[model samples]
Target: MGFFTDCSRALLTILSLTPASNRHFSQHPLALQDITIEPEKASPGFKCQYPSLKGWTNCNGPNSRDCWLKDSASAQPLFSQYDIHTDYESVFPQGIHREYWLNVTDKVISPDGYLKTEGKVVNGSYPGPLIEACWGDDITIHVTNYLKTNGSTIHWHGLRQLHTNEADGVNGVTQCPIAFGDTFDYKFKALQYGHSWYHSHYSLQYPDGVAGPLLIHGPSSANWDEDWTPILISDWSHRSAFQDFYVELGNSTSGVLGREPTMQSIVLNGTGSYTCDPSTDKNCLPQNKRKPIFSKVFQQGKRYLLRLINASTESAFVFTIDNHVLEVISTDLVPIHPFKTESIHIGIGQRYSVIVEAKPSAPVQKDGNYWIRTVVSDGCGTINQSKPEIGVIRYNAGSTALPTSTNHTGLSTLCADEPPENLVPVVPWPVDHQAVNDVLNDTFEAFVSNNVTHGALRWDLTDTPLWLNFSNPTILNLGNTTWNPEYAIIQESYDRGYVYIVITTQAIRKDPSKNTHSVAAHPIHLHGHDFVILAQSNQTYDVSATPKTFNFNNPPRRDVALLPAGNTGGYLAIGFKPDNPGVWLLHCHIAWHASSGLAMQILERQSEILPTIPSLDPTRKTCKGWDKWLAGHVLDQDDSGV
Candidate 1:
C-alpha cells in the first residue's frame, strides 16, 4: 500500500469512482429531498397495477422486472415503497428470485472512510442480490420505483439476451427509463452460463451502488463434490472529498487502476468483522464473537465453487483464501480453460468463478498445529494497500479440533497448483526520448467505416454499409452524436504526443466543416497490452492524410495516460496475445462518462473450454402479446442458415 505514491498531481486524471458522487449517481429526477425508506416485512412483489406508458407492464415479479416513467413528475412528491426478503442461499440464485428497488436514501460507507448514497437500487441491497441459476432457467423480475422523481433501467451485465433486445436494457439505446410511480417487467432466459451481474443501465446508479452478483451454475453433470459461495467485493465510498479515490489511485506508485487505492476495507461474502474496525478486520472470530453470520467455512478435499464478483465502483482486489489453490473456470460470464492459481484478479464490475479444493491436512506438522491463511492484493497486479489477513480453515470445529495438520493434504492432488497471471500488462517504462523519436518519420493509413453501438453486439445489429471504416475522419463523420446543434462546436486542441483513431465520431462531433471543437480525450488504458504513443495534433488523426506506422517494442507500458483533453483524436497500438478469455473493459478513465455510456467490452478470443450462460426456459414466451412483437424481431444468425 505504501508503494502507491509517485505521480504528477496536476495531470492526474480522476479515475477512481464511488457509489454516491453525483457524477456517477447522476441526479435522480427532481425530488425535494430523499425520504427515508424504513424496512418492514411485506409480501415480496407488488400486487397493484399502475398505468403503463409505451405499453410497458409490471408482470415481472420480484425476480425480474422493467420500469418506465410516469409523465416525469416534480414536488414534495410522496414517494412509494417496495419490500424484499433476503436469505443465506448459495452462490447461485434460484429461478425467478431477486430483489429490486429504488434506494430513496441512506449513505454507503467505504473502507477508506467515505460515505456514498442516492438513486434507485436493485434488490434494495448494495451490490444487489446474489442471483444464482442453473443453465436453461426462466428468470423473471419485476421492479417498482418508489422514488418520487427519478427513473431507471436495469441491465443484466454480460448476459446474452439472444432475441431479447428490449430486455437488453441500455438507457437511451434499448428502451427508456422506468419512470417514477411505475413498474415494468424484465423477462429473459439465461442463455449463456457463467458468472454474471446486474446493475442499473439507464442512469449513473450503476456506479452508485446499484449493482449485484449474477451467478449461473454449470451443468450438474460436471465432476465435483462441493458447495459454492459467492464473495462479492466492493470498494464503497459515499462522497468524501478527503477520500476522492483519484488521489489514492494516481498518486499511488501504480498508475490509476494499476495501483491498489487505499480501500476502506475488503468485504468478504458481503460482511466483515463486528467491531466495525475495517483496519483490524479479523475474520477468524467465531459467530459467538462478532459478525458471526459472516463466517466462511469449508471441508478439506472438496472443490468449493467460489463466485467472485468485483462490485467496486473503483478498487479491484486479488482474493486469496489461505493455503488453497483455486482452479479458475470462468470470468465475466465466460470461461477460460480450468487453471489453478493462488489468487484471482477481480476488476471493477467483473466476475470470476473458481473451484478451490481445501487441503485435507496441513503441509507441515509444526507443534502438531498449522494455520490456514487467506489474503488479497490489487486485482490489476500493481500495489496493495492492506496486509494479508490470516484465518484458519478449521476442521471439526466443535469436536476435537485436532491440531490442524496437512498429513493428507489433497490440494496438490485435487488441482494443478500453478498460479494464474494477472493478465493486465505492466508498462515497461514511461515513453522516453528514444521511443518518441522512433515514430518521428513513420505513418500508414487504412480504410475507415462506422458501426452502430447496438445493445446486442454480434447480431441483427446494423447501420448501413457493413464494411469496416479505418480512417480517422472528422467527429461529425462518425455518427456517434445526435446532440442538439446549439451546444456543439469545433476547436484544434493539441496533445504533445498521442493519437486517437475514433470509430464513432458521426454521433459525437456532429459537425464536419466549421472547424468544430467539442471533443474530449479518452485515456484508454490497454489491459494486458501496451501500445506506442504517436504524435498528437488539433482536430483528429487522419490516417488517410497522415503517417501510420506503430512501435510495439520498447514502448511505454503504462497503466494510464491521457489522450489530451480537447483533442479530436489520438492513435496507439494495443498488443493482445489471447492469454485470457472473457471480455475486458475499454473506455474513458473518467468514471462519469464511463458510467453513462462510453465503454466497450472486447472479448479476447481463445480455444479453451469456456463456460456458457444459463439458458432461459424455452417454455416461457414472455406474455402472449409481447411474444409476437418479439418474435418479429428475433435475430437469426449462423453460417449455414439465417
Candidate 2:
C-alpha cells in the first residue's frame, strides 16, 4: 500500500521531473474564474454552507481547495427528469475550439434511497436525467453547444459504444466536438441495463458536475421482490483545493498546481451524516418535508438485494448497516459467485449487490433506528474516519406489529445463505459478454529518481530516463532534502501538451500542506476500464511475492491506485478487451490533479480507415483547383495577383 500524506510536497518534489515539458502551457492561459461550475454542494459530510461556501477557485486536482469546494445544499427536488436532444460528438483540436457549459444545474434522481442534487444538473438532477429505454430501444440525444469552446463530446460511462464508434463521444480521437452552438444527435440502440453515468469528454468540466447517471431497467433476471439502491460517493471542494501546496514551492518546482481545500467531509447517499442529524448548527439541515425517506419491508427468511454503487469521485470506503453483513455478489457490471463478508471496501466506479435478509425469528432491535456505517481511509485501508450515517429499517412509527415483520436490518449477508434457486439478473447485460476470455494483455513498471541537492529533479515511470527511487531520491542543497516524507506527488508534467493526471489529492488528503510532513498517495482513476498494476520500483507500489500472479482468464478491475515512494511498490494486473473503439481516456481519476495537469489521453483503435477519396462533382474543391490552374495561364497583371 503506497502512502502519500503530504500531497502538496509530493507534487512539488515530483514537479522536478520536467518543469520544462509544461512550459508551453504558460501560453494560452485560461483563468480560474473561467471554470464553468461554482460551489454549491461539495460532498456528503463536508458542508461549507451557502453564505460561507462562496467563490470561484481553480480546478487543480482533488483535495485541493481550488475545487470551488462544495458549500452544501438541501433542496427537496434534487433531480427532475426532462427530455433533451443532443448529438454525439468528439473534440481533439489542440485547444482550437471555444468554451461551453454543462451547467451542473441539471438534476435527476434514482429510484430508492438516493440523495438528490440541489442544483448543477441540466434541469437540476444528480446523474442528470435518466435516459429510459428497452434492450432494443433506439435513443438519440441531440447535444446543443452553449459554451464558447468548440471541441467536446459525451462518453457513455458503461455503454458498449461498440458499433456506434462515432457516437462514442470522445474528443480528438473519436470525432471532433460539435462547433460551438452546433447540435449533434447521438443515436444508439439500448443494449444492456443497470446503473450507468455520462459526462463530458473534453476537460475537467466533469468534476464541476458536468456528469449524470444513465439507468437502463431491463427484464428482471432474479425473481426477487424488493428494489435496489445506488451508493454514489464522490470528493467535492468549492474553492481551489490544492492551492496552498502550489503557493509553497512556487516556480522553484512544478509547484502544487492543485487548489488547496479548507475542509473534507463524507456524504451518505449525497446527504450529510445522519450521525447528528438536524441537530448541529447549520451542519444539520433544517427539518424539511423534502428529505428523502425510504423503507424496506421483507418477510422473515425472505431475500432482498441491495445494489451498492461506490460512485465517489475519490475515496475507497467500506459500506455497512452496522448489524448486517454484506454478501459480495456482483462488481462493476459483472456477476461473481455469491460471497458474504462482514463489510466490503468499495473504491470509485466499483459496484456491488448483496441480498439482505430480515430474520423472521430473530428479535428486532427495539427501535427503528439503524446505523448505516461507512469508513473512509488511507491506501493501506486504515480507517481514516468511521462515519455512521443513521437510517431506519423498522415498522412504521405507530403502526401495530403486523402478522410478521422480518428483521429490523432489511439487508442480508452473502455467505452461509444460498441465494434462492435464482438470483437477480445483472441488469442491462450484454448479449454474451465474456470478460474472462480476452487473451491479449501487457504490463510494465519503473522507479523515480530525485534531485534533493537543489531540492528538485526530474522523474519518470521507467528507468529509461526520468524515473526516481523515492526512498533514496538523492542528496540536494543545504541538507534541504527534495525527498520529504510528505510530498504526495513525486512528479508532475504537461509534457506533450496534454494533462497527465497525477495525484488526486482532493480525492484523499490527510493534513494541511507545509505543516504536515507525510508524503501523499494519490488515487488516480482511468475512464474506459480498469488497468492491472504490474510492478513498481522504489516504494512507488506494493507487491505480494517475487513473481506476481497473472489472470490468464480474469483479473480484478479498478480505476485508481495509491502510489508509494519506495522499493516495494504495489502492483495489480487488470485487463479489459479493447473491443469498444474510439479515443479512450486513461488518466488519474483525481479531480484536482486532472484539472491542474495530471491527465493524458490514449488513442485506441484507429477510426474506420477509408479508401482513396471518392470522386466529387465538378463544383467541388477538386474541380476548383483545375479552374485556378487555367486562370493562371490566361492572366498576367502581376501574374493575376488579385
Candidate 3:
C-alpha cells in the first residue's frame, strides 16, 4: 500500500479502538510565543494533556528567531533559522528532510518612505521570512497565527500539493483559516524545484503584507557563480488592502464599475520612495530612517542567479536591468529551456529564474551602479509612481553612490505573457490522445457588473461569486450530498486523464446604454496543480473551431497564466490531469477581481479523497474553532472567501 493508504488504515484502526467516552476533545492550549532555536537538549517527559490522543507530543526547539542570515565578505548568505549551513547536493540529494516554524502577526511600519501602515507580517518581518528547502524534501511548516484580529492561512504558491491537499493552505477550501492564537502544521513534499512564495490566502490579508519568498534548491538550467535571494516585485498602496478592496467592491456614488484604486507607488523587495504630501499628511517623514534600497554586489565576469517573483495584488510588471541581458531559465516552478531576453513580463503571483553575467564588457559607470527596473504594465492599472520602481546593482561592494544608468529604449509596456515557444518545460508533461475520451470541458464567461441586491460592483466567473462557509471547508465536506454545486465544479474518477477548461472574458458596461466597459487582462491562478496551457489568445473562442488550434503535444505548463480580457474577448484554454485528489480553487490573482467573485472550486475524486484522509479530527477541530469564533464575532463577507 502507498503511504496515504497505510495512513488511512491506521487512522481507521485508531478510531475504532478508541472509547466513545473520549469522542469529544478540545484543542491544546494556545501555543507559546517563544520560538527560539538553541542547541539540542532533552527534557523530562511531560504528561499529555489529552492522553487519549495516541500520536500527540510536546513541541520541541527553543523559541528563537526562525530566519536569519550571516555576514559574508561577498554578500549575506540568506537562509532560514534552522539552516545554519546548506550544501545544495546534500540538502537536495535524491530525498531529504526539512521543517520550519512560521509565526504570523501584525505590525505597523512603512516598508517604503510612505507614512506608517499596518502590515500583517510573518515571523515579525515585512516581506515575511524566507522558506528555503531542497527539492524532494519532506517539508514541514508549523504556522502559528497571532494576527489578533483576522484569522490567517499561507498558500505555498506553485507547489503542487499532490495528494496532500490539506497542506494546500487555502482558507475555506482545503482547510479553515488558522484562528488567532492558534497553530496549524503544513506538511508536504517538495516534488518540484524553483522559486515561488508563501502568502496569506485569507481575504485581503496578503496585500496588507503577510508574504515571503520560498525557494527549493535543485538543478538549474544554466551555471551561475552565486544565487541571491528571490526579489519580490509588487505594487504599493498607502491605505490597507482591505480599505482599497471596499472601493472596488463597495457601493459607489458615481456609477462606474470595476475601477481599480490607484496605487501610490511600485515596490521592489518592500522598498520604494512614495512622494508624501506634507501639507495633507502629519506622518510625513519617518525619523532618521531612509527607505532601504535593495542592492546586490557583483564582481566582473561572474554569473549570478536572480529569482524574480511578482507578488503584486493586481498589477503585471515588465522587469529589466539597465543595459543588461537576462538568460531566462524557469517560469513558476517549471524549469524551462534557457533563453536570452532583454526584459521579461511577469504577472501577479508568477515567478521567474534568470541568470545575469556581470561581464566587464558591459557598461561600468563612474558611480559603479545600475538600475534594476520594474515597470507596471499598461492596461493593468494606474499608480502615482513619480520615481521608477528600481533596485541598485553595484559593481563594487563598498559603493554607496546612485547610478545614472538609463533604461533600455522601446521595451514592450503591454501586459501579456512571455512567448509560449520560449517557455517549453525542461520536463514535459505527457499528452494522451485517448485521454480526451473522458474529458470534462468547462466554459466560463468572465464579467463585471453591479450587484443590484447588494448595491456594489462585482466581477463574476459566471454570474456567481464564491462565498464559502468558513466553519465547513470543502475538504471536510467530501461525499456530502447536501453541498451546493453553484460555485463548485465536480470531477470524479479521471485518475490521470485530461480535464479541460476554457475561460473567456469580454468588456461589459455596468450601464447597458453606455458603450464603454471595463477591459483588462487577468492573471488566473490554480491551486494543487500545474496545468498545461493549450491555447491563450485575445480573440474570442469559438466552441467548434478553437479545439483545432489547441497544442496537444507538450504545451506550456504552469500554475498561473494570463486570461486576456480585451474588447473582442480573451480566452484561455488549459488542461490538467486529475491524478491528485483534493478540493482545488481556480481564481483570478487580481485582488479586486478575486474579491468581487471571479473564482470557482474543483472537487476532484471526492470518494478517493475520503479514504485517503480517514482522520478528519484535526480538520474538525479547526472547523469547531472557526465556528466558535464566528458565533461571537461578525466577519463582513465583502470579498470572496479565498
lDDT of each: 0.36, 0.35, 0.71
Report the C-alpha lDDT of model 2 over 1-642, residue by residue, as the tens digit.
011224422442343222221312111234433323222222223211112112422221222211121212323111110001000111000111112224323333322222323223333544444444322234567665444322235666656543454455544334444444455555443444445566665443454345555544332223234444444554432322223223222343553222223224454444443323444333334435234433345454545666665544445565665456565655544444456655665555555666665542244555534445555543322212333342335434553332232323533321111222222222221221223321111222322223221232212122122211111211111123233222222221111211212221111121222221223334444544434333222233222242233323223333344443322233323334443333344433434333333333333333321111111121132223323443444321110000
Candidate 1 regions with alpha-carbon error over 4 angstroms: 1-121, 220-222, 238-263, 273-290, 360-393, 398-593, 596-642
In model 2, the Cα lDDT at residue 16 comes to: 23
Error of 2 at 77 (Å): 46
Q: Is candidate 2 or candidate 3 better by lDDT?
A: 3
Instruction: Flag clash pairs in model 3.
Output: 35-63, 35-64, 36-62, 36-63, 36-64, 37-64
Candidate 1 C-alpha lDDT tens digits along 220-255: 111344544455665443343223423422322321
lDDT of 2 at 417: 13
Please provide the root mean square deviation of candidate 2 (C-alpha atoms, Å). Answer: 20.8
TM-score of 3: 0.82
| Candidate structures ordered by TM-score, highest first | 3, 2, 1
**What TM-score would every model get versus the actual structure?**
0.46, 0.52, 0.82
